[model samples]
Each structure stands twice: as structure tokens, then as C-alpha cells.
Target: MKDFLELLQRGARKRISLAELRQHYFSLYPDVQNSPDRSARLLETLRQLETIGALSLPAVGSWEKIGVPPLPQWVLLKREPKAVPRKDFGNVAWAPELGFWPELRPGQLETLLPINEFLLRRRGSLMVVPIKERSLEIYGDEKRLDGMCTGDSLFGGRLHLNTLGCFRVPQPLPYRMADAPGKPVLVVENHNSFWSFGEWNQQARCYSAIVYGSGDAFRLTGRALQQVLGQVAGSGAEYLGDLDPKGVRIPGEFNRSAEVGSPQVSPALVFYQWLLAHGVRRHRAECVSFDAASLERWLGAELAAQVAKVWQSEHWIPQESLGFEQLSAGVL
Candidate 1:
């Protein structure tokens, strides 16, 4: 990382005075105050740089020195790139799953789960679910409240609906790790492997998966995942998307949005390894899993081809096709 002080100085573009230079240096290394000689040495280094013409002296007695280059390109770039905002579900309506209410909110769900928010949208009266919670408070004038909260909705287990309003609650995903009795949970994205891993729960040892319903889920589901991982701390989270380029890129964005670390696996590599062991020289993407095919179809022909090139070059997987029996036998 660039030294923060240096970066700030570059942006200001003004010569620093001697006092300012000393203050800036000491601000970053407070311990330098304890050693006068060390502090003096630092000042000497700066002076030496100026003497050698590595820095510019705008005035006879100014403390601030202009850094010389190949000036870093950072000076040319005015603003840092803005990250795309994550999808948030907050404005969705709320109501009890079965209980009756006098009035209904425009959105259907009351307590938004993290997973639900990733899939939902807000427009007019619709809203994506906010972070996972159990309850919601009824602020009168749902429309007016909507304006304050923007398009995002909140959900907690406890509903403090003091005002007369409705609430909506949807079924939550059941995430269970397959192996250790109380092992850490692992969130898997692949649908088939998600179910298969669940089925092989006893055999796999421990760790469960949360399936990605579709490409759309990657956006909002990250929060839900944080919630899930929070409940199962120490769990090893893994994303099992396709080996294609888009699949690889999505995980990177997902990690940023969730602010969590979850490494992705290459199902194609797994399949490729399996075929190599089984003496199968040739295989198609769909043979390893049709869901992989569906993903390609969804991405469209142009992007799909781009992703294929990436998988073939960087993430070729040959063992993904092997069953658990083969895996356990070390045939892979």
C-alpha cells in the first residue's frame, strides 16, 4: 500500500515547510520522538534527496519538498474507482407467515433474510431484504417510511409492530455441514454438489452447503451467507461455481460484497481429473454437469465462449466427474 501521508501530500500539491515535514514524519512514527538522532537522520535523508534533485525546493526555507519522479501515475488519476454497490433489501413489506393483519405493505415479506434480499428487488413499492433479522417495527405510513429507508428493508426475529401493519416471512434455507458432528459449515454454490454433499453428509465428515438458486443470487445472498457463517463460526466456506471465467469473476465480487473470504473450486478440474483417471480422453462441459451447461446458456454465446477459453487454459478440471467412491479410493 502507498504511504498514506505521501498520497495525501501529492494530492495537495503544495510545498511543505520544515515544521510541517517534521510534524508529518513524527505523526507517522511517534517513536521517533524517543530517539533524537534517529529523527535527525530522517530529516537528513529528506535534505539529501533535495540536494540530489530528487525533490523540488519551491522556496528557500520551506519545509515541504515536492517529490520528483517518474512522478507516480497516481498524481494523474483524480479519483479512485467507485465499487458497484451491493444489492440491499429493505423496503419489502412485512407480514406474519400465517397470522392476519389489518393492512398490507406493498412488499410481500416482512423480515428479510440475507438470501432473500439477494434475489429480490425494490421499485415503486418493492424492496430487497436488508441484513438478516427476526423482527420488524411498524412505522405508520409505509409509503413515507419507504422514502426514508430507500429501497432496502430490515428483518429481525422480534417484530415490534406497535402500529397496525402486516408482516411477511418466507422459508429460510436449511444449511447443514455434512461431516463432523459440529464441524464448521461450508457454503457451496454448485446446485448438484450442494445436494450431493448434503446427501453424503455422513460420508463427507462435516460441512454443509448453501446452494445458489441462480446467477442473480450472487448479489444479495452474500449478506445471508455472512449470517449463515456467523451462526456457524470457524466454518470453512468454499464457493463451487463453474471453472469458466464468469464463474471465477463472480466469486471475486461475491467475496467483496460479503466482506468474507471464501475460495472457489474448479468443478471442471475435478471432472477433468476424473476423466483422465477413467481413461476418458474426451468430454464435454455438460457431461460433467448440465447445470454447468445452463450457466453457459444463461451467459449467452459471446460471454460463454470467453469463459470457456479461461477454463480450458487456467482451470481445467478432470476429477470433477468422479463420484465419492472414486474420491475416497484415491483414484482421483
Candidate 2:
């Protein structure tokens, strides 16, 4: 019965039909197929829940709607809840319907009555507080229903809380470019390769900045890279990755993302030819055919044909093989 209520709460839809419930139940517990009269037992359980006011069955409908009441306050309060000295607990509110509080002080609330009232009023929602415009604060407590309050540490001297500064719930790729360094940003596929370029740049100082592609040129990384490239136009961008199917696909994706007709290649055709001739090969059996169409679409026919030839020969050269010496020498 508790599982049933939990399932309904987790569902996006407010109501569920009997047929859907049976299907979901069987899917969740496949072993139930061996039980005799499984449907009858499930119906009996529903009837029991209806009797206890946990759910309701309409005379004219085939669905059982959730009717569980909000959890009681006593269930939420710690045996002896206590308020922190000189700290404000007024803003935090409890949400009993969700079975937890939001934005609560870590060690506050000595009594249960105040906390209970807070829970009853909010039901199960966090209380919104007035924050400075364009500013965002992170506050959530699954225990008490206090309104909202910002912590001193979060707002202390080092960091300013704002939309731009705040670490949003889901972070995008780590897209960073050095401050107005130079032209032709170097975009490397793997983190190791990006750092390798960083080390090489310290001495060679060829590129304005080095961007990490975070593998496969994820859409977020591509978009962020495109924006960074836009800010520094004439500089353009060069892509470098392993000489394989995925590596070829990444630069192609980047060209589309940056909306460039013909993007520059990294390591130069001469260097690529050298690597194809001398570079070590591993995972030959696992090497799959390259997507010739995507390669052609992004890298142009000349480079695409070169990569396809390498793929056909079952030869792959990782970017690391280029070595710091070759990289620093501006081999590309």
C-alpha cells in the first residue's frame, strides 16, 4: 500500500486507472504471475485502502484516485527539536505532503507545535523568499518546512550570489578560453590532449586558448564553444583528436555547431600522413568503419578520404602519440 502511494506521488499524472495500475504492478513484480488469483488479491488490497481513506473508487469510473491525507506533524518533529541560538528559523517551512521540510536550519526548533503549524500551512511546498533581482540562492532541506533563508557562508566575502555566478543545478561543460590571448583557438578532444596543449602553449605560445571538447562534442560543449569562437572571430578554431571514427565525427560536429563552411584541421596533413605511417596501432579488431558521409560533410572530401583510408587499413593513432616535443615544435 505504501509503495502504491509512493508510485502515485512519483508519477506526473495526478490520476491513474485500474488497468494502468495492474500493468505497472505486474511490470514491477513479475513473480506475481505465479500467484493464484493475482488480480483478485490486488483488488482486495485496493478495497482495504479505500476503507482507510487512502484512495477512492468512483461508482461511474474504472480508476482509483489517490486520497491519502497529508502526513501528521508528530511524524516529522524530532523527539526534541531545538532552535539554534541567535539564528532565524522563521523563513523555513515544512511540506508534509512530500514527507519532508525544505530550507530548514540544521539545528533549530526546540518544540514541535511551531514546526507542525509550518508544515500544515505549506502542505509540501517550499516557501518563496524575496531575493535580490537577477540573483539565485541554493536552499533545500528535506526535513523542516521553513520558508527560505540564505546562509552567511554562501554570501561571504569570496563569492557573490547571482544568476551568472551561481552553480546552476545542472552544469554545462567546462568551456574556458584564456583572456584575449591570441587567434586560432586550439580545441582538443580529450582532457589529456587539452592539458598537453596547455603545457605546450606555455613554451610555444601558439594558440590564444585551448578548449576541452569533453569527448564526442556533446551539444552543450559545442554550443558553448561556438559562443566562445564568436567572441574572437578572425582567430577561428582548430580541432585535434584521435585518428578514428569518433575523432573524425567530433570535428564534423564542431563545424556544424560553429556554422563554419570550411574549418581548419589540426596536426596538418603532413603530420597526419607521418602518424599514419609511423604511429603505433592498437584495438585493430575493434576498429569500425568511419562514417564517410559525416566525415565528408564536416571535414571536406580531401581529409575525409584520408581518414577513410586509415580506417580501412584498421589503423588508429591517438592524439597523445604526437608527444609534447612535436606539439611544442608547432608540428601542426
Candidate 3:
């Protein structure tokens, strides 16, 4: 039941049908799937919830058209009827989007008092506080709230840490610079490509630097490119990766999310062209969903059309298809 409400709260759609619920939730939780008379029990649970105005069926096969807000309220009453939060909690709130809460402990109310005290102080201002700094100030331990922000665990059942108005500081990307004084830097998604590019740059001196994106690591750390480019005096950056949905998404998202004045990240067009013409293809069943607008935006019309055909065929080209020796031979 808790899982059911949680899924409705976070699912992309505002309302989920019975088929989607069965397909998604049943496959994910074994206990729910294995219950005796599970279908009957699930319908019974929905009927009971409907009677209480906790949720509504709408049609014969739908569940919870209006999500989240009303859900945690019913769940709170059902699970912890004996333990309840006081009405005087002021401007502080448990993030309404979350459809769950932590188990209330003995001194949980007392613990929540100070946590709310910290949150209330930050209520009106745009204070861009560091996550650890905010965590230490609110909770006693500096590392107490690490990895507890999303869907994991709510602290003390009364406070939502995500609403604390704090931001995470991303770490810098790992990179190697060419000894030469050129301004254009190449960003490589895989380590092998970075090594090949780095070795080639050492001799060819074609680029000012080569950045190792470590697959998806560059998404967060790549935000720091304004500072990274400042170090090398870089004009702009070109991104090259495996010709797949995820690889395309990495750079597209990275460039879109970049701060003003950050070095531009474009597809390593020349390298991608080579990969398109000669790169080896690996077939993957799940690589067919690259329908994001970023697909056309990042790769342009012509290249995106080619990549779309590859993705539709359920295949992708690896960056490694362009080897070390060829790169060292000034093959861009």
C-alpha cells in the first residue's frame, strides 16, 4: 500500500491506469506480486481507500487521479495513528510531494523542534547554502543527511531535508592538458578515448587539452567548466562519446545545463562522422528510446537523423571503434 501511493506520487503521469500499475509495481515488489488473491486484495485496498476519500477510481480500471497530497495523510493515519505531529509547526513542512514518512521514534517530536527551527530561519531568503553546511547546522552531524535527500529515508518524520534550501557542490572533472597553447579542448566520454586522445594530443599538440568525462560523471562535474576552461584559456569544447541514447543525452544535457560563460560543448562532429561511417555496432534492446528534443538540438538535423536510424535499429556505435593508432595519426 505504501509502495502504491509512493509510485503514484513520483510517476511521470498525474493519473496511472490499472495496467501500468500492475506492469510497474508488481514487477518491482515481490511481496505485492506474491500475495494470495493479490488482484482481489489490490482492488479491495482501492475500494477501501475510495470510501475514505483517500483516492478515487474515476473509471472501472483507474487508480488515484489526484496524487500525492492526500496520499501521505491517509498513510500517516493508518501506520502511525498513535504518533502524530503537533499542529503548531509554523512555516516548516514535510515536503508535500513525498507520499511517505519515517517511523516516529520516542523523542522524535523533540528532535523535529530544532530541525524546524533551522528551516524556519531560512524560510524567506535565497540562501544558497552548501548541503553539508546546512546538514550540520540542522542535524548535529555534518554527514548525517548525505544521500538522504531523494526517496531514501526521511529524518525524524517531521522534516523534509530536500526543502532545506541547500545545494550540492559538484566535484571537478579529471583531465589532462596538451603542452601546446591551443584553445580548443576535446571532451571524451570513455576513459579509453581520453587515454587515446591524451596520448595523441601529447604528440600532435592539436588541442589545448583532453577532458575525461568518466562516462556520466561529467554531467554533474561538467558544470564547473567555466572554471576549468579559465585554467587552460579554452575557447570552446567538443564532446565525443558512444553513439547511443545515454551517450547522446550526457553531452546534450551537459551543454543545456551549463552556466552562462561556460565553454560551449558541441558534438565532436568530425569524430562522430568517422564513427557513423566506420564504427562497429552493438545491438541493445533498450537503446531505442532516444526521442528527446536534445537529440536534434545537440546533433543537428542531418547527424541526428543518422543516429535516429541507428537507435531505431536498436544498435549503437562505441567510441572505441575509432582506435588509438588512428587518433595518434591525426585522424581528429
> Poorest 10 consecutive residues of model 1 by lDDT?
69-78
Report the C-alpha displacement of residue 197, candidate 1, in angstroms.
1.6
Clashes of 2: 21
Each candidate's TM vs. the true structure?
0.34, 0.45, 0.60
Q: Candidate 1 lDDT, tens digit per residue, 1-332?
A: 12323433454644444455556555544323334243444545454444434444443333323432112111112233223232333443433432322232212222123213322322134333322221132222223233222113322212222222222222343575443534445444455655554565556564544444244355445545655656655354555454443444565555544433533222333333234346222334443332445445444455455445534543433213444555456553
- Per-residue lDDT tens digits for candidate 2, residues 61-100, read 3332431221111111112222223434456453343223
Worst 10 residues of 3 by lDDT: 72-81
* Residue 82, model 3, lDDT: 24
Question: Considering TM-score, where higher is better, how would the candidates rank from best to worst?
Answer: 3, 2, 1
Question: Candidate 2 — which residues are off by over 4 angstroms?
Answer: 1-182, 230-234, 255-274, 329-332
C-alpha lDDT (0 to 100) for residue 220 of candidate 3: 62
Judged by lDDT against the true structure, how good is candidate 2? 0.50
Please write out the lDDT profile of model 3 over residues 1-332, one tens digit for every residue.
44455455565555555566566545443323543344554566555655555455563223344532112112211221222223443344653432232443222333455555665565666366677787688766565455344322245233444466665566777678877664778889999888988887788776788888877878766546666676777777889999998898888777765655556688889999999998999999788876657788888999999988988898999999998888766665
Q: What TM-score should be assigned to candidate 3? A: 0.60
Best lDDT among the predictions, by candidate number: 3
